[model samples]
Target: MEQRVDRVEQRQDRLEDIVATMGELLIETREMVVEMRRENRQTRRIWIAIARKQELFDDDEFQDVFGDE
Candidate 1:
């Protein structure tokens, strides 16, 4: 019975460690996602500016709106 209890405690400790590692990974993944979104926004802005310059999008209203991005 004592050995069984010890084994249970060891398993519980290992489970706790795994949970903590998963939490850290979740936080890192969230940070990476945020960074990627920011990069995508910047890339979109550059593309729009290029298109405007090339006159592919020749609406003054669109120019006014995307100019702020």
Candidate 2:
């Protein structure tokens, strides 16, 4: 019947909408994970730089900042 066809079409439309929203969410999550990884790498580089400079500082200030390096 025509009514049954209409119902099926509506259901399909709703499913398509859900799929689109899920796809958008997946893309956003991937971007956020990538950004976090980049930030972590940058932080590691900064720590390495600080450690390399440790010999320049006197014992007390270095210990205060870097905790008994």
Candidate 3:
């Protein structure tokens, strides 16, 4: 009976350790997702800037009507 209790206690301790590790991993995953969202936002801003500049290039009347302005 004592040996059985000891085995159960050891298993409970190991389970607690696994739970702690899973919690840490969850926190890390959340942080990584937040960082990726931030990077995606920055990338979208750059794309918008590029598209605006492209519109200017596509507008030939922009130069003919407002030359060197």
Best model number under TM-score: 1
* Best-to-worst ranking by lDDT: 1, 2, 3
Worst 10 residues of 2 by lDDT: 60-69
Whole-model lDDT per candidate: 0.88, 0.83, 0.80
Model 2 has an lDDT value of 0.83
Candidate 1 local Cα displacement, residue 7, angstroms = 0.7
C-alpha RMSD (angstroms) for model 3: 8.6
- For 1-69, candidate 1 gives per-residue lDDT tens digits of 999999999999999999999999999999999999999999998888788788775577676767655
TM-score of model number 2:
0.68
Model 3 ranges off by over 4 Å: 56-69
Please provide, for model 2 over 1-69, each residue's C-alpha lDDT reduced to its tens digit, 9 standing for 90 to 100: 999999999999999999999999999999999999999989866885676676656677666765743
Task: Report how far off residue 1 is in candidate 1 (Å).
Answer: 0.7
Q: Tens digits of per-residue lDDT for model 3 on 1-69? A: 999999999999999999999999999999999999999989866765675577755456655644444
CA lDDT of 31 in candidate 1? Answer: 100
TM-score of each model, in listed order: 0.83, 0.68, 0.77
Candidate RMSDs in order: 2.6, 4.5, 8.6
Between candidates 2 and 3, the one scoring higher on lDDT is 2
Question: How many residue pairs clash (N, CA or C atoms closer than 3 angstroms) in each of the candidate models, in the order given?
Answer: 0, 0, 0
